[model samples]
Target chain A: MWMGQSSVDFIMAGCKLLDEGNVQSFLDNTDIVLTDCDGVLWRGNQVIPGAQETIEKLRKLGKKVLFVTNNSTKTRAEYVTKCASLGFPASEDEIISSSYVTAHYLKYIVKYTGKVYTVGPQGLAQELNAVGIPNFGTGPDVAENWKFEDYTTLPLDPEVNCVVVGFDKDFSYVKLCRATAYLRDKGCLFVATNTDTGLPVNGRFIPGTGTIVAAVSEAAERRPDIICGKPHLPIFDTVLKLHNVDPKRCIMIGDRLNTDIELAHNCGLGAALLVLTGCATLEEVRQKQSSNSIADQRLVPNFYLPSLAQLGTLIDSLK
Target chain B: MWMGQSSVDFIMAGCKLLDEGNVQSFLDNTDIVLTDCDGVLWRGNQVIPGAQETIEKLRKLGKKVLFVTNNSTKTRAEYVTKCASLGFPASEDEIISSSYVTAHYLKYIVKYTGKVYTVGPQGLAQELNAVGIPNFGTGPDVAENWKFEDYTTLPLDPEVNCVVVGFDKDFSYVKLCRATAYLRDKGCLFVATNTDTGLPVNGRFIPGTGTIVAAVSEAAERRPDIICGKPHLPIFDTVLKLHNVDPKRCIMIGDRLNTDIELAHNCGLGAALLVLTGCATLEEVRQKQSSNSIADQRLVPNFYLPSLAQLGTLIDSLK
Candidate 1:
């Protein structure tokens, strides 16, 4: 994923990159731009300026606009609310984040004859329910909801074909044990929402869905079939499908190399615009770019931007 | 996995079950009763009563005997040494187990490559060496010599077609990380020695090879392909292939049902005897039996005795 440039440098550098022209050859022909939310829009709650205006400009140009994120803690409604509060008018329909992507991914791969054993919050379940995927799991209202016995562990029947894992701070051992046993006996599939490892916010890093997923993975001996969210594929697919845009015309924008930049690299899409205000630094970006892990070709960012406020004037240059 | 049954009880029970009729049936007709050392003869050199005499009686009848254990924890020389000390006259040729089984299994599955990144002890390495399977692991005196980079956190790699997880207590985190990575990336095969969760000696429980194997399985999110030692198939297969004994005429005996009883159950061979002196109790045996977790409709022991020394009276009854 792209390690974002700071807002100031972002606008200045992005303008230069755009003005440098080959990039405009990129944006001018681009039909869809799947932007990540965590590091792109606002640091946490506050707007980074020009985020709304950029969305407006893209929409005014009749471009498909979708905010795909790996974070599933917030539901679609919360995302819309957050977008509105940040001056960008958003609807549940306008966003295709990891949370939503995971829900859709589940529909495509997980064959559910009955309710699914969900491990995320309302947005995820709602997305599943909207698709008529029966959400079979119980919540806190049903404490001890997940028991080994409650699961069809041994000689598992075909009624339950999938188990979806997401961010749940209080996940229990019983669920893990059941998953392990079920996978062991029946060989049912496993899928996770994302693999962000950890989420960074307000200068503090908390264990992301990846960490939680890894914990269960360490016990179950089965990696999820698909990591549905950002830095993976489902969200990107949904963005393109929903926008009806050719991937060649798509650009991914984000504030981190791990989430935003890596997504663009993995997917056959345009370069990322890494903003420095999020998770990684210039030094880290440079070091990671040279590392074999991310690969030289996979490391991307068409522009190094400090922030979006500077981009407003640059858009004027286009006129 | 037959638990708590002394090794001898395990044998007698398995012999009697498959033999049917009075105890005389086993004594009269049985030719070769191959025994795996890990869960069968002794866990790690503590004697299970009746093992020596039981083996002696069977040998006296001109039965060809082999001490097969999947555990590569000791070398052929070491096994012979251990057996001789236990009052069983064992030679390198007479002692056969998983190292031999795995070496053959490797040849049957994957052609002998240039080198192998072994993860067990000298016995395992020697077994492979004898079979012309080049050992790529470090020497015994090398002091934690296995390189950590060979393994990974994602246990998926096409290169790692087979991994042997035996007894390696100095298990560092790096080994686990690499093993996990290999399992995930390659979907590589894995082979375990035994499934005994814990080993007992001096009335204390010590984590056995199975515990370590479980950790690898957990980290890799993939179960090993075969548990090579007793109760699984490798050791038994070696004996059967070498001794020319029919499954019906054979009997398996061990302390743990997870291994010994499991072997008899899986093979449709002779009976399984539950002895209380080693791993599990008779009570557990009955419980597992009711659940059908134990093998079904095979040779089950016609008798459950604490030790095989009592077999003289049992033999008298047979007469």
Candidate 2:
């Protein structure tokens, strides 16, 4: 009955725990499975237990599995190689990263042919290069002898029509000024890889792309035209268009409820499953469920599992 | 009649053009006068036309005058020297800069003796030193080769209980991460000098202190506890306390409506005058006067003057 309605009520009503009985039911209708890489597949360098087995089992079952990640530090090719090295059945075509999705969006959806003023890393540059998007303002640290007047006389390329922001170790005041100057022209497209407030670094979180993006936004006093990442429609649409996913037959699995689960709901996917291996816990899921507001209710996932390790056992039972 | 009322209506009603007849009447009761330095006194290194003469005339009339500025790049002694060089009579006691006010607020109002984590220039460090506030997190450039793991394990002083942000030419990701980490304690005091979005550089504007402040705020997901700059009460209260002036007998004059004129209204000053010599034009003041909304109406200055040069003539005619 709730199959056609694209409303919050329909999504909330379908949320429950994915059990052994429901695993077969979920797999029967869902042909495509999208899972987040970092928390779901691996925490850092180490892989999550039984997660690789579940991905391999899904591929063996003729399921079109794709790895969707918001970590824009690595290009799509890097993600593919990293995934394979970790013993997961992965390829370049099956990896959908924020940087890659951003490139795809700029090339296909917007039909943007102009040069990009990028404030990001080499990985972002590589992805843009793959799609034939020329970029400037990426490398080169701010000069030590930079005067206040130099910013006014900044030599900007006239062909640059887009300002892209992402995670860059070399992010500096020069890059910030150039991006802000390009964005001062209201017609120029403003795009950010992801607005993840913090990124995990050695078991602790530090400032992420959002912090960099926020500085430009505040200086310009304007919001980005689009953010090509999770919880936003551009990245989800990018994956859907590339893979030709059926909304009612696709499921999303991740560890965080806000980004992974909310992204699933926003894209009108079949279901979203939350695991306890990431930022969210069981107590948080329960708290979100008890909340009456529509926004809080949206954070509620369709299913809860202790870990993706349980999915490997369920898939094994099928054999 | 509306001497005690703090409503926006009273402030808006008190606005009028400073004419020959009103000049004497306005000055008769007003003994203390505050003014912004950049566009009002001088634009860059050159002083405004007749600005020095007007300051001299006011002093001759035995009126107390103070220069209120948000430029945190220079110390109070530097400002006094710069003012004298520009032919404007000024002293350290007659200057109120954002850095000085920030130091005063921490030392007097908050009574905070703990060390500070500063993301700003040497001017701020000097002010903090003057007040005997031990500080860290300034002057040093970001490491040449910083890894993500370094941020998680970055060396931080335990005594640092306050995070101060201002215009820093040496601002970097390392400084942003350290400030965010210090602020993660939740008990740490977060203070910003000013939120000027852009600073004028040879006619064009570049990113200012607000841009740097915003990045830390976004990463920490918390607003600064105190912003000791124009339109904020702390700086205004600092000047009033240091000079022991009456708000009912004080007046503010500047070239911008937002920071300068708004500061006057917020402080319950007797009058505010807008001069068409800076960022704002005459048309903007007219539009604000015609606006129906209370917020917009507050932007309308009580009086409009072509320039401070005209005030010098009016003062001479009286003699």
Candidate 3:
């Protein structure tokens, strides 16, 4: 019997390492694969060894593969191009970035007509623009020779009725002040792409979109109206609507537990497969499994692999 | 009977409005007056009516008056200048700003000798410099025409072992990145001036130090080790050590209940007097008084006045 159709007992007994004993059954149950891009497929400009082959093997086995990322720094088109260059060979339609969901949510779900003041990057802005939504405030907007008093008289666009926050290298105090001013209006919408605190790159960390969102939330004294990203319902809902995939037949494969694996549990996916090519370690999985908290237990993925290379080797052995 | 010497019965009966019947008794019990500037004394460049006269009257009655403010944008010297210009005529010793408390705590309490990475204005840096602490990261540290990839290679000061956050108009992504990197070390110290979300200025609001702190905290994945501002013990402890005033004889007066009034209650001061020339309103006081939570009830001041002008009139009438 496919694990997707099995009882809740299988999910409860999570954190089992995938090998010859169970790799075939895991693949048999998963008809659709939602894979996180960064740690699973690539780290910075370098692609993880055998990740490309694993994704290809999954696709060849008739599994519908989708590239899912909490990163809002890149648009779907940009992601597609990057994926191709990195050997993942993805199409724009096969990519579901946080930025894409943000734009989709605003355009289709909210049906917003007003201008947006975005505290993000060119990719986020491009996503919004692709959906025919008017937006501004992407790059550096720092005031020259500014005083604290200048903030009081800072001119705000009267047309902006929404504020979108994401990852922006040019995030500045001026942008924070502007966002707070717009968000002060009760009717104005506050949308965040994701709340991932830090982005890990080549063994280093940089402040992520969540840092910027935290600042804006503090100043506005309010949380985001909607967050369209992993471990949150909005992104999953978007995936469900766009792909029309059965949740029971889907497995989310990623490296991080809190975001990728927790998102799998939150969305009622068939199973979550954790790979050790990124942030999480087996020690952490063991800790989560031993923990009594249900929230922590949910972060325990159904299967673990040393890396995507192990999955590729297992698939080759299946032949 | 002096309410300061009275039992818990007097404190339970908080939110009493000051009038002719109660004003004299309230003052007689208060040996030291801790008054907040901005809304209580002045708003922007304009001083509150009768505020100067009220301070004069308090001093003439032999009360030791000190200016207590959560604002970290200005140092003690700047505050003294601002006070004299606004007719309050305060000396540097009477000025207790959050910036001053931050420097005091780091120099005297933590006894930290490491270079500080500050995310604040010149005044905050000046205060730290005054205490012989070497610091940097003031003004705009933004990367011109920067890409997200540049943040990965962003150089961090190896000598910086502490990150002090306050209000900074020049706050940018580069500063947030660098702060996060330095804070990754387990031995690094994280300190914040205050957590006031917004600074209400002439019917408008600007982001405060707390906003910046929130960003840094989110990125660093830790709360400040010490927040040297209102409602926290640091600033009040500084006051007690430097001035040697009994908490039971010190009354806190301010426009905001959350910071000033809550600080008084937290420190077990004689009383908290709300002057409604600033952010808070009587309606809010009533709400806090009616709240079931002890924390909410703590925000209820012992007394309230329409403004300091009423207190001045009451003093003249007594004379």
Candidate 4:
């Protein structure tokens, strides 16, 4: 009945939340578990040796496990593709990206029935249209080119409702000129997908959407109107609703301390399990748990794990 | 009746182009005609020294005149409004602003179907939309509220095909971020209405859209998609078409030597004017002419007068 055994068990068994009493109560009450990707399951590409098996083991014990990510550029489909390619079993609904949250937020404000310009990929644009926010040019063989300066000359036309910023490399003088011009005249809205600084692929660092977002910030003289992913609304709430469990009864788990741990704490969900992989290194977790913390202390993970597979009896004992 | 004394008549009567050439040939032959607005009979107020009436004088006498200016933000409509208000009897088609030329050039290479975000007043944005471009959001509402960075993340989207740059003093961090982010996105284009470094209002200097555009460029790492306005095209071409005449017979009559003179030279019409009223002074014109002689020689006027009212005798002599 133990299902499997590995070094992951010792890590989980010895886990201690900073507020031990609160964590214990949380463990006793929660029926659902939310997990962050990257650090929890793998580092760069080599899975933490037993992540998949540990997840499978946890599921067999009747604990609902979920995964979340803050990277906004990739769509749910893209995330699914990545997971599948990474040899993980994932369904579209099982994963979330910042882009998803952004789309949902826009829907709350108004439907974009006009043009939308971005420093992002096709995925982010597709998300907007998917939610009834019609794109600027939606017809076949539609050929249109515009410069930033053109916006200033024609601000009230109502053809453009929003400006979505994501990751882009083609930033240039011409585009900036036109975009800012429009900003001053019509007062177009601004929204950012996510704030990840960089993404690791093939053992190298590639610029993330955050860098692009920051660049826009430097020009526009402000930050995102709203950030759609991580520690924001709906992502955590949606997951809780799906399982019919209260947030207080849910245990959020993830590899990155910042996204997973912070999200869980911000939403009143209990306990974050820090795994060493993805964006944050093990050394970083130790650093935060020790003095130089920019974040609030209550958000710290309840438990620490070298690998989920490193836990054995704790899986059974927790139940 | 000779409005001016017979003494002025000989000077006006003996004018070479009117006496020896036909309208088309004379227009083609004359390099430039400079005039003033005050004494000229404009639509009403004060075409001032030689503004509109001077152009009328040149037309009957077979001289070519090019209108120019230093006020970069005003669109052709604004110019038309001023001319009409001043009783200049000119169409929006006849007058030119640095803004008009800026918008004109942007329309040429860029293709866009979405809403353009703009900063300046209605004249600028309206001018662009009239030619078939659209803009995002409207006055003090969305475009004003949304910063450039937020443009990427929200429901509106980041795949902006183009951005139009203009001036806005309240421009904040959010707008800069959105624009910067949008520009970095691949394939998005940028444009500026004008490259004015600063704006003059109430005797104080403020950074113009050019400064903001440059900031965006540095962040995004590219040059302007295009700079419209001032000696640029599609503007001059539009003006020529308004007269229902060929370019060989068209002229630009403006107050500023650089904008008017340079505009004419660039368009293959002719550059010839300077007034103490605009940004470039007579001293500046003289220095510029001597320094860059190609367009510089053309900068000198065939006719230099204190005002246009002195042309009555000259006008009758043409008959």
Candidate 5:
């Protein structure tokens, strides 16, 4: 269903289905594999069939595997525990979560010394704490029985020099007020973990970190100074700093094209593999393929598979 | 500081200082005056000097006076009370607040029948109640000790077919979750009162309705179907339906350039007068005047005074 010369060129360049003819060369050319967790490995609590076997087979082939997720609600330690529980055994070093990257960016990259006013969950705060960065504002900070006028008089911490926004279940008007107030200084750095708009749950959706970040950005009248997440440069910078891997030999496999596939494109990775088991569809890939916009074109993946199970089957046939 | 021929033409067409040579003609051409409340008449509780006298003089000169405000936290009746207390006595019919227009739009314009899930204050609900529209979700709706998982399971009102977002002091994550859920249905209408980012309070700022709207928009992955406030046509449409004043004979005066000045430009009003007592400054007007962008040019006002006090002085000289 490719349309023109441009579409044909894009199809030939990417979005090809992994087949017997291409599987051997694809594996031979890739040394590092960065796989997104939420949709690729599992949908919520249930793991995708053969995902564990595919990862195991990749590891047995001497391919370095890393669980790269934009989910900022969990620390690397927490992700490791979750990964083990889900049948994909992983260590802290192999988990490149957004929270870990944010902490690493702040601690090592920015070398920030002042206190951080975080509008996030406990795990996000834990990551900051682990990096020895003073932070607060995790739990409910709602203004109970207080008028809008009270919010103006609410005392702000003078020590706060940074505001980090992530997935916050306890997000409230008061926290938004405080975040805006701190950001008014202009010296205070505004950072966001990720901008995933919604999280799918039980076939439904709940507001994600993007929603919280949007709220703060609106109030602050500014976009985030830095975003330590997929599709952004900070997370990739962290990956490069921590691990030695050739960019042209790295493959990123994710179910979402905007975040995972775009991340691969942004980082100049060798390949982006789209799996039909999650948020994106083959129809979407075709739509992007025909679009003239470079931004939309970048969402097109280099490879496609029905699921990782199919990849596992392909590998078994080769053996 | 005008740059090119276009800049000179823009300045000659608008952004002229209201002086004795122009005051009489400007006043004679206007049959109705639409004035913004927050920045123009008063900043917080204290009123701008001579603002009340200026309104009284406008009325004595046989001009219809209407208080137009983007603040959606107050009903028209409540606005009347606020005006009376502030010495610029006004009737409920003279008050055209965003909340009033929102209710009017949903009630008469759209002829909406289903229950409205509101994320605003008591005054917003009062406005909807006055129009006999069933609404809920005003006060604090936080997820006390519950996790993010609980938000996905939170019961949604089946009757809710519309989500109205406005200035809410008790805005919380649970409220955002519900709003996002209701807006997920493509059939459900999404409405916002206004998108004022922050309210300047006691020299500081508190997050305004825009922050909440931004959050909900991000989560829902869609913009509001309609916004009933300044610079948008819905509120002006409400004004036209309620009053017999001609657009060419009506003038809008305010302190903000984006909302107040832009509204006058959008409505084909006779003149837009800028008063430097609140949000905007003379420097901003110059910036807009010099900009080549048509959108920026639209923000430039027809006449400007240091404050309403200067307009009062000009009128006294004429008498």
Candidate 6:
């Protein structure tokens, strides 16, 4: 079966059993591979067993690889350091993150010149600063208690014409006030890093960047002008442009159905392989695939394995 | 015509012109008058022109007057002090506020025994304390930067079974984490003061209590169980019970259609008179009334005037 052209409704019918022959055929048909970081590669800090070996083996087989992530809490340099320390060393150019993509979009695509009012952590600020984009409202607290006079004299920076929101731990009423006022002008561009409602940490989910973005959007009464994250095309388009890769020869491997699988679908990638190592459970995949509902079709994976390690073992046996 | 029973679609059709005859007729039909503080009586510290005189004249004409406010940043006592200093002296018992209503709900209605986790300022905490509801997570810097281990070690008060959200100047990431964790327990009650998206300050809008509430709600992935503000039954119920007034003889006067006028509509009050001083404009009101949408019906005021001063003039001439 030409699994790449098969509809999501036919995904279950075309499920390739991970025999050595099936694995070798799937591997030979792909030239470029994109992978998600947190779930498919590592749970929290520790890397998944054999995930590193599989990527390296893929590289040895002449396949191009890229690490695409939604975590905007760290700079690309920090991610590079983290990869190297975890025994999966990667170059800065090989990593595409929401934080990095936001900077890239602001600089190259939008050609923005004004200061950004960022409702995020220092990491996002550092990325913007690295691209020579001046930003405000990111660091330590400067907002005081609101008094009667504060109504007339709330501090505002007029130079801010862009507001970028991410996973902001330092989000305050003052920052919210400033961003809302700036957005009221409508000339200001509103951008968000990702829309992951909650993030997994230590086997549990906590509030994520999407929560912060939702708050700003609700208060401003305006949806984001651009959202650079999974299930969106900006980051994937950036990665494709940087690597100069053909979309038809690329496959995305991730553990999330909504973000990873749907991202590949949105980007016109060849296929998406779900590894049962993160948020989606096997029962959920079964429910989506067997259903005749067209809306649920987008969430069905092109292929799924019990774990990335199982795929790694299959590929190793082929070698 | 009895405007209280008039169709919302016919609100503008029955609107009283600011003539001596029309104004006198509107005054003659009401025994209790309820007014919003911020936009109707005053705009930030400076009382609106003729507002105080209008209230004094209403009282002289033997109308039972009460001040209703959504500002949860201060206690009823503080509001009394501010009102006294601003030329419109009001007693503590005559003022109904969101903070007061929230406290009353928790203490009397729910009879909550556990401590509260408050994501608000000193005023909300003080009101909760006055009602003997012990609360934590207010009025200081307790939340620190989240470390990786914070996922497991975030400080949480075991006794906190309710989370009250309002306009908190001291809100931070640590508080968000704590609240999210507490809410995940499922037994905890989530409450908010109001959901007004923004508040006008010195002719400009700033992010208000709704902004803060939205942030917490998004992060928690839960909606507030109780929102004790204008147009909501809790605050109005508290005011009605405290004053022992007849709803059918009451009239609500204010500038905002969505909040003040809707509050009267929701309470089954006798009439709603819109003043052209605050958020809603004539064009917007006319559009809402003219539309066939049922949702817009609650927002249409029974009558409208140029200002409270016009109503004051009508009453003085009657005297």
DockQ scores of the candidates:
0.03, 0.69, 0.78, 0.02, 0.72, 0.52
Report every candidate's CA lDDT: 0.58, 0.84, 0.88, 0.53, 0.88, 0.80
What's the distance in Å from true for residue A23, model 1? Answer: 5.4
Off by over 4 Å in 6: A1-25, A151-155, A287-295, A317-319, B1-25, B142-145
Off by over 4 Å in 2: A1-9, A317-319, B1-9
Please tell me which predicted candidate would have the highest DockQ against the true structure: 3
- Runs in model 5 deviating more than 4 A are A1-12, B1-12
Candidate 3's C-alpha runs over 4 A off are A1-10, B1-10
Query: What tens-digit string does per-residue lDDT give for candidate 6 at A1-319?
Result: 1225543433545334456756776788788888998888888888889889888888888988888898888888998998888877899988888999999889988899999989987778889999999987776563565564564466678888899998876776667767787888798999999888887777555778887777678778898999999988888878766877767678889888889887877776777888988888878878887778754667777788877888778877885
Q: Which docking category, incorrect, acceptable, medium or high, applies to candidate 2?
A: medium
Supply the TM-score of chain A against the true chain A for every candidate structure.
0.83, 0.95, 0.94, 0.75, 0.95, 0.92
What does candidate 1's lDDT look like per residue over B210-236, in tens digits?
655655665555677777776665666
RMSD of each: 15.3, 2.5, 2.9, 17.4, 4.2, 3.2
Q: Regarding lDDT, does 2 or 6 come out ahead? A: 2
Interface RMSD of 3: 1.0
For model 5 chain B, give the 10-residue run with minimal summed lDDT: B1-10
lDDT of 4 by residue, B241-280 (tens): 4445444334444444544545555665532333344345
What's the lDDT for residue A96 in model 3? 90
Query: Residue by residue across A1-319, what tens digits does model 3's lDDT show?
Result: 1224332454578688899998888889888899998889988889999899888888999999989999998889989889999888988888999999999999988899999999998999999999999999998899998866788888889999999999988999999999999999878999999999999875778899999999999999899999899888778778887887778788899999999998888788888999998899999999988998987887899999989989989998895
Clashes of each: 83, 2, 0, 155, 0, 0
On TM-score, the stronger of 4 and 6 is 6
At residue A269, what lDDT does model 2 achieve?
A: 81
Candidate 5 residue lDDT tens string, A283-317? 99999988888888889998899999998888877
Which CAPRI quality tier does the interface of model 5 achieve? medium
